[model samples]
Target: MKRRLALTAIALAVGAAASLSACSPGTASGTELVVTTFGGEWQKNFTDAVVKPFEKENNVTVKQVTLYSSDALAQLQAQKSSPQMDVVFFSGGQETVAAKDGLLAPIDPAALTNAPDLISQATAGLAGGRGPVVQITPMGLLYRTDKVSEPTSWNDPFNPDYRQHVAFTDLSNSYGTLGMLMINQARGGTIDNVTPGIDAIGQSTRAGDAIITKTSSDLQQAFAARDIWMAPYSQDYAETLRKAGQPVGFAIPKEGTTGSFITANLVAGRSNTELATKFIDYALSAGAQEKFVTGMAYSPVNTKAVVPADMQSKILAGPTLEKLVRFDPEQITGNAAAWQKQWQEQITR
Candidate 1:
């Protein structure tokens, strides 16, 4: 399709330009490190918990290039030969793309003092030993208290009563894509054959029941305007919204939830490998992981990171953690692009 082709062209153009600006890794000084990060509240939490502390301890000046994970990956691809970034943070499975492209170096676990504190899956989900998972937040439904009835079945997203008021993140978002997989499997379709899910989306979209928005801030505004009542939402966002006095509550669809694991990766051949590695190690330390989870409501990857008794039911851990719908990262990578294309062609039509 022209859209896909145009996107590819733009990327190629960006890559061509970035190669000129990207420098060789070993050429940099030890005092400066660059990282790609998201903006707004998430960035604030990270700055408080990870960035500020790392800078204080290591005496390094971290220059952040603000970017979403997807944008960061594209920048990496563009600048891989002479990457501007020293460390990258992205969702777990997504790092595999950078790994396959040879943009990420394998992390030395011995360099990480906090490595032993992580849960097995978090440590293992590292794009095949290329990095480490820093934190995780499970994805599920969140709804306004006054707008609609409780959602017991996952099928309710398509129900007529919810029509025109349901908000959804676009499929490009990890939560949105994984949400489709959960719905598909729950609707008796396999990951490889998600026709039922696609059909349901088409039906909802055509009926004008699906209101697609791009970010948490957008969702917050939509909820305030009462244009959206329910969404495939994250626990962290839900908690933040509730604390800010938005009448939001977690909705447990009978089908359960999926985890979105965040990973930290070192750029391949970066000049600041030592400092970059230390930053990652510091992030995984008990102190950092604790702040990351409790401050933002994301579940910590560190086994030793404490979740207070009051917060247990809201976070993924113990019994809730045990019940998560874990998918193969390889499965997602193999299928996601095709799925996104199909979703655009069919569901968004």
Candidate 2:
């Protein structure tokens, strides 16, 4: 969920317009459930793996509104008085803030049949009264294998030879935020004091050694056109670039990496809490998890999901999964605003 104000406004407009369609009577004459999701390929993968199956089993029509996590949060706040959305997807710990703001409803583990199958990492949110973590995307260094040598460390982006060829994601993106935090931590800066990371990256940007990108699409375009040789991005997206025929390689730097735990939460005030919980449970099921793994290359949070050895190498699993550097979601949620402000003023500006 990386974005700036303008893109957010456009997303809100789209949400407002799409909300009208969400209220329409179902032609199938069944229950209707509205959910928030990413657009394009992501929406297609989710529909194939989760939405369509859930719809068939439950006899419900699930309407998906395409919005990044930030805009989705904004739309939830706007509709807080009466939430039109039943299920919402979040990747950047936005669920933490949304839950605290009462925009999300609590989950009952007993209501979710797949609760017992979830990995311990996915169950953390249940105790905090938020939704269970449905999927995970690890952050890592992405490089064009042909254009640059493999990056074994996060500091590789700062190498003088790669100047002007390094793409830095703005903090508005969730992965961007995590990448910056990882670099900041690797450089001896705490979450409360990210100046070291900011200053170091900023020095490169100021010297015209790096290009600041606003969205995942931007990264793809840059890599596709050879505008950038390397960047810090999520592993799932790295696969996207590879499948698109870009010569891409992803690495979990020696300093370690973090991950985006995409969560599916029941929106507060939705009349279809039971149905929404059912959908959430289906998303966490081994069946659906397997589909997501094959369709989207996302790491499954269900311990029972069977990923082949070859496919496992493509995702954040096994030894690579164990290398994840855990950060406090509560701290990240609390400091996100100030960090964003600092990012704009000190880095992007």
Candidate 3:
């Protein structure tokens, strides 16, 4: 049964009284779990789809802390000696670094009943003992349909006709970097080399043909206010804009796109390991995955999760799904600092 606000308040009062009792020092701890999640609409949908159901089924209260992937990792490192969060959600492969630093617990595939239903891509992190990819958002081109014709390739942002109306996501954002890499690869640039992409975007910026946005909100505002007609962003965000009544569309440029995987990991050294793992398993289940697809337009990593026919055209599937380019996480992680520095010195400057 769903806990109503009044019941939750009364339970909190009762719990507080119980905590003060000498015999119940850890009573609440046993029934409470902390998990880190994203903010805004992401958190709302996640709570409705996964958290609430888990809380109801497990008869536990899930305390959700809003933190982006990188910030959440930093918090984990800070709390390593006395970990507070039980489970962590990561969308940018920060789990790779978290696992390396021993901040994340190794997930046992056998423990996850939904493990068998996951697609191969979702299991990519399994061999390395990282968390499973619960969901994915395809990084693609975001443009105003009413402002410009559909973009057929990654190179369309460079068209002179769209001068001063293109937006490039700064290197700090994962999707931004992925977008840059896609263009680079399309023009024959390797992961080891980002100069072609950097130079291309720099030229556009220097010529006043494009603008650089440091965050997703900046991109949204730019498009909303009609300052930018096009940008390389993820599909879910394109939906965000459309829902806001903006005339926008997402396109998978011919060069293909990359999948932004959102993973749920068990935090190391937490007493709630079993419950935390159960939550992770629940998130990977088809029902939870389908809820995310319907609520947030995210592509499911579970093959059994069905997308409605009308929604199928807006998400990654079929040929578009086939076009997913899996980049080396190591390449992105190892070179991120250098790329950021270069972006500042060569592009942002």
Q: Write the per-residue lDDT of candidate 1 for residues 220-282, one digit (tens) a residue.
A: 887878568888778788898888888887766787767787888999877788888888888
Ranking, lDDT, top scorer first: 3, 2, 1
Against the reference, the lDDT scores of all candidates come to 0.79, 0.84, 0.86
Worst ten in a row by lDDT for model 3: 19-28
Candidate that scores best on TM-score: 3
Model 1 has an lDDT value of: 0.79
Off by over 4 Å in 3: 1-28, 318-323
| lDDT (Cα, tens digit) per residue for candidate 3, span 1-349 | 3569889999999988876752332222768888888889999999999989988998999999999988998998897877778888888888898888888888889999998888777777877868888888998899999989889999999999999999999988988998999988877888899988888998899888999998888888999774789999999999899898889999988777787888889888777788888989999898998998889999987778888987887898534454588787767889999998887887756
TM-score per model over all chains: 0.86, 0.87, 0.90
Root-mean-square deviation per candidate: 10.9, 10.9, 7.2
Window of ten residues with lowest summed lDDT in model 1: 20-29
The best candidate in terms of lDDT: 3
Compute the lDDT of residue 171 as modeled in candidate 3.
87
In model 2, pairs of residues that clash are 2-173, 164-209
